[model samples]
Target chain A: MDIFNGIASGFEVVFQPNNLLYCLIGVVIGMLIGVLPGLGTVATISVLLPITFGLPPETAIIMIAGIFYGAQYGGTITSVLLRLPGEASAVVTTFDGYQMARRGRAGAALGIAAIGSFIGGTLAIVGLSLLAPVVAAFALDFGPPEYAVLALAGILLVSSFGSGSAWKCIVSATIGLLMASVGRDLFTGVDRFTLDSPQLADGIDFAALVMGLFGLGEVLYDLERRIKGNSAPTPKVKNAWITGTDWVQSRMAIARGTLIGFILGVLPGGGATLSSMVSYAAEKRAAKDPSRFGKGAIEGVAGPESANNAAATSSFIPLLTLGIPANATMAIIYGALLLQGIAPGPQLISEHPDVFWGVIDSMWIGNILLLIMSIPLVRLFIKILQVRASIMAPITVMIILIGAYSVRNSIFDLWIVIAFGLLGFLMKKFGFEPGPLVLAFVLGNLLETSFRQSLQLLDGSLFGFFARPISGTLLVLMIAVPFLVMAVRLFLRKRVAQTDLQKEYENA
Target chain B: MGVPTRRSQDTATQSEEVGVVEADVDDEAVTPAGAWSHLVAGGVPLAFGVVMMLGSINLGLGSPTSPQPGLWPFALSVLLIALSIGLLVGRGRFGPCESFGSGTLTVIAGVGSIAAFTILLPLIGFEIPAIVLAAFWLKILGQESWRVVAMVPILCTAAFHLLFVEGLGVAIPHLFSF
Candidate 1:
């Protein structure tokens, strides 16, 4: 379909009352989670997953996507008000956002951030609409070999770029693959790891695992530490509108941030956090007086805010077109899609046009909703932040436990949730990332299927993967990434060591 | 997407620490007890890998031409073992292992409550277990006020009952099945 028709139809999907309502709910929940520090989008989405079980696939995705991007907006409220970032992406915003608040220009800073985020997110949607179909069409001809290589590269890139050590990420992913191997083997119809248990026969439940690992696990971890309530006085918003000078100063920064965020967001492992930091640095560098950055500069708030929202939106490109999640949040969304029986990939646009377009279109509406509601809702969201974590944590755990049981109405699933929850807590304590494990679990079957199929098609020759143009390129890139990272690290280390040597000589 | 070089691991740890503070819980800070902790952490995956390898051997490792189910798992097991060894070898670089301290007791209580809920829910229904779990957490772990500890559980349980059972019609085992 053409871009114009796709967008028009997308609007039609978004206009449905059900989709619109869910979109609103999603954003509201997203904002709430974003404003609250302990509960992240990942856990929130996991806990809420069962609620979407009865909805149509398109509505389910639209709502979940809303939560993902709407969070980018919600995070700014805390950063500007309390100098405490409610979300990881909002960390940089606290620099100038809090400064502006202290200077009694809090309203102006927030207003500019909201405006910039709207523009950035909307622009990214347009870019997604224009680019997604082309990429999907290009990948339409990917054979088993290409898919195998792509999946391998995808897993590797996510692990290497993820929050933990590459080896740990790999181990987590390997464990996920092993978990996916449980139940009856697809190819052989033989039980690989079920251990004669009836529940194990069907394989481990995804919803149960997620709720346990992310939801309950989070609760346990939070139990280990005390959460201090916010003592910062709420900044009064006397004037929420930015002056004409503020607009002129921030317009270019917003545009640059949008562009930077969009480009970076499409890369595997690149998301809101990276984009925000880079945009802030970029704005600082481009400014005539860089010294104004940490001192209530509107550009500082505008740039990173725009960049994060834009990055959040554009990160969908990989998940939608390539079937590879760009970051941890996208990985959860990918699982949601799979639960809805939709496998996201190059064929998704062709196979599920309504779902594909509806999600993208709803993003435009979600942004509009955020822009309209953020100002009015800021006070309400701030009130949510004041709620004590002690009260919230157990309630969240109960919800997760019950939610886990709700899926398939099995008590065995509850046990699974508890088990994985404990495992997740220990993993966190020991510094292992659950994101890669989840991502790997979601992609495990696909990876294995592609690998075996590629081998079969290539007459059992491993070199067959390298014979194809696309697959070969992907394999080469995968092989090169680790070496490249190692080289960069080595160079950086040498530079630091040399600098220290120079300091020592000077001191002597 | 914004910055090319910012590591996500750093962001995750920062957010987690932030969450801890926001929750108003005082943590007993202690450094990881060096090699022993590292050994424990790394040993887990190594143990699992060893068990998996042993299991796969019984399943028969078929050739590449027409692979068996065990072949793929065996490959991953080998990878897991290798990574675990690497982790042990470079344990110092991974950072200080955090001692659970006083929080360990809280974790134990929390987990115990969940286990109690699971065992009791099927037999006695969800209401009592739910209330008890909430109250335990509030009073004991959270150290909430007696008034709050008394009131919140009943209110939360009522709300959840309405939402999950009455409104959504989820098939939770309640005291009154109707």
Candidate 2:
């Protein structure tokens, strides 16, 4: 009955006028950002982080959560109409979605994608609502040793599963941990890396670092591309209604997608992009005519769209329950929660029950808003894209600078943002995925404090960590995950290659 | 004393074990920059690690039981150095990063403008610098026509003023009041 009570309270919180308004605003911004190619969810969230500070934690999270899932469906519009994937997860949508558009079934494709997204998102919310409390309850028994090990394992998983080399990702993570170590040491009261600045005592502002990396950094990197200007013409959207056949075909695809997406989204690094890709493949295999897979197959669009949306919703489970960010974007949300003075771990359900239930329940509301708005606003979103890059460049830069200053009303944060901006740009240029770095940085202090406390219990024996049942099991699993993943991936690649060869032989 | 010594040794080995699990992917992001960019990338972290370590040691590495403030950071600094070394040894084989090219000047100008804005903000309040920065981005960076360049800065600055200063009553200093 605690679950029911929590749900009831969540509805009470979300239905408030202030929260409802913010939710509407968030979904709109999310749709626009999703439609735009140059900017992404991470950059958008970073820009808005400062603005969220003034709002209540529950309201802030509700808005942010709305933006996240709204962006998932926004990408589908561009994919079907313009053959451009607005988000990484939407890449698979462009394949059959664009083909459907070319075949003059654009309306059918769009309508089905919207419907599929709704089902997938709604189902994922149900899963999150059911699963989050259970996970939180299970994690309540965890001590410092378990926390320290869990934090390390989380970062390790993100790095190993990231797009870049494991070495580079880990190295990036190390830098984040190192940065987290700056300022005075709490235990001994000794200054570590303050560089003699009094303001450094409290450590670096999370807002400044993130705004620099994701916001200004993306702006700087995308500067050249903006100069060239966008060349794609907006396609007209019409008759956004699907046929019975289309719905029949898409229903099963959406169901399978929801399942695939929910499972992957719970993992440390398997987020929307990976889940969407997996769902697309699964749909293709299940199809009666595999040849129709890429050439305007409605299931192709339905499955991946559903999967991406579902994954987007379910990825919140880790952060809300375990206080471990599942992906890069979640890392920023985690930072936002911390800045709100709301600690996100097992105690969150009891300590900040309003915020917890409110965020989850808000997703249900946000998804409905996305479905209602996305189809009608297709032209408006396309028009938003037509606005010259010149207009956006100054505005984005201005917001970033002003936002940085808002952190503590300090001029120093402006400089800090610029420095991290340059560093972030360089890292991106060098193919370093900033996700692991951000995740590691967010978790670094938590890991450190827990580790130091755990050491007292271990009796000064470093080996005692692995000798304990919980920490030891976690560490062993941490070691095993990368190897197991690599082996499975290798096996799959070989099997696919053989399958391709056999298909070629049969065709010949 | 012996316990502290043994703990440090154990931590080092454990770090190395983590390091050895360097499972690589076929990364598509990096273009073939010369070893120079790779060297710079590797060397920055290495230098950063060394500097942090020196400071950490100065902070004092207490026993695991006692756990000084620097102990965790100090351990991390060592790990940082090892990882950077591994990166340097990579010789651009894993993912050779992109070198700075034609876009360097644009970035430099962007950074330079941001720096100028930061300096001018507290000195002259936010209006003049805001106008100047907006104009530079829209005109110089954006390469828009004179009409757009003339109109956007003042209007945009006014909107920000309305939102932040008037609506929210943020503590930022501004030259004008309504």
Per-residue lDDT of A147 in model 1: 83
Candidate 1, residue A20: the lDDT equals: 97
Residue pairs with backbone atoms closer than 3 Å in model 2 (clashes): none
lDDT of 2 by residue, A1-508 (tens): 8998999899999999999999988988888777764567888888888899999999999988888888887878877876656677777787799899888888888888888999999999999999999999999988989999999988998898766678888989988998888877766677768889988887887889888988888888877433333335445667678898998988999999999999888878747876777788788789998888778999999998999899999999989998988888888889999988988998999999999999999988988888888666555555554444456677788888887787689998998899999988888878687778888989988988888888898887778889888889989999998887677446534423334322222111
How many clashes show up per model?
16, 0
Q: After superposition, how far is residue A53 of candidate 1 from its true place, in Å?
A: 1.1
lDDT of each residue in A1-508, candidate 1, tens digit only? 4778878888899999999999999998888777765677888898888888889999998999999888888888878987667666777787899899999998888899899999999999999999999999998899888888877777787787655567777888889888888888889998988889989887898888888888888778777765534433467876457899999999999999999899878867636765776788788879999889789999999998999998999999989998988777788888888888899999898788899999999998999999987766566566565555676787788889888888888899999999999998888777777878888887888888989988899999999888888998888988887676557445534422334322222111
For model 2, what is the error of residue A358's alpha carbon versus the real structure, in angstroms, after optimal superposition?
Answer: 0.5
lDDT of each: 0.80, 0.80
Q: Score the docking of each candidate (DockQ).
A: 0.35, 0.24
Point out where model 1 deviates above 4 Å.
A479-508, B1-33
